[model samples]
Target: MSEAVLETRDLNKNFGALQVSRNINFRLDAGARHALIGPNGAGKTTFVNLLTGVLSPTDGAVLLNGRDITHMRQDRRVKAGIARTFQINTLFAGLTVLENLYLAVSEHLGRAGAMFRPAGARREVVDEAMAALDGLRLADDAGKTIRELPYGRQRLVEIAIALALKPKVLLLDEPAAGVPSAESHLILDVIEALPEDIAVLIIEHDMDVVFRFAREITVLVQGGILASGPPDEIAANAEVRSVYLGEGTHD
Candidate 1:
């Protein structure tokens, strides 16, 4: 088998006395699209935090492509090819869409230090920013401030920022949350079109999107993995039914 693009070895985390993630042994190969799902407080978010360095694990290690990166800083993780979007929208609400993309391009280009540099001086950056917007079919809105866009458009901006990083492994924390049913189709399309070379791990509650996009599913319950496999297997797991599905409908 190919090496895992991302792996967690016996990962564990705690919030005070409550263990929120326990022995999160998992791996994603390059090009895999994986989904993580469970009821609220199941420790899904906590597990992602450990992987991304937002929260250190109480025990265990996070490995990126065969290298240990458990203690790496968040920025270092980003530079190492891990990029993520938040559950809530994260963007420069006051800036135009192109300007927001410019910031992302700047981060990728190592120009974040040159605050005095004119945004117009970077032709390559501008070109890349435009290309990213075009790929998302948001080229027409490039000049509009994020706050002026619809809520769904603003969410797309956040994703565009992460895409600018050229991530080898992308972590999307609930990209469909709070989006209108109509607008969610846009988000789903964008996700479906992401580069096939990149591994995608998504933590989302929307079963429709999860089942539609993810090739494999991992279910967590109270800080532990209850079941994992293709969606069909996960849905039929008795433990998953008793702990998570619990009378909820399934596709």
Candidate 2:
């Protein structure tokens, strides 16, 4: 097995009297495709936020490639090779696709900010952005603004932006959410095509997306692990079925 790219060691989080996240131990190996799924209030988002440093844990650590990064800020985490896409598309609606991706590249390089100048004018940045977009089969839409593209394409752009950072770990929070079923496959294909060295951790409600994309599944309920195993084992587990899967048709 590969060394873990991202992990939480006995992590916990709370808001005053409300304890939303429990002591959670999770691991994602290099190149591993894994899913984190549960009921709506399962604290999945909180865990993602904690892992990405959007929210600090009340206790425990977040490790990146065997290094402790539990106290690092979100931007530092990005530079350290952790990137994530939100449940909502966070893009500059007026900016062209190329421009948006360039923002990612430039940010990763710690060069000019997206507002300072046209990143496309920077040879190195544009070159990197173009390469990423091309891989997603979205090169032709490079000139289109974020608002002009369909939801699916925008979702792809989100991944492309994350890719621009050259991250060693990618956390995708509902990459296919809000996309039409017809176009959702584009999101999955893009994810499937990513290089195998970057660990991928996805949180999805769509069983089709989860089962198809993840080799291993971790079921979380109330911020704790309900079960963790291969897809077959998760599918056959009675506890997971009753608590999460719930008789849904699965592939």
Best by TM-score: 1
Local accuracy of candidate 2 as per-residue lDDT tens digits, 11-30: 98999978888889999998
lDDT per residue as tens, model 1, 125-221: 8999998898888899999999999999888888888898899999999998889998999999999999999999999888788889999899988
RMSD in order of candidates: 1.7, 2.3
Count of backbone clashes, every candidate in sequence: 0, 0
**TM-score, prediction 1:** 0.95
Clashes of 1: 0
Provide the global lDDT of candidate 2 against the true structure: 0.89
TM-score (all chains, Cα) for each model? 0.95, 0.94
Which residue pairs show collisions in model 2?
none
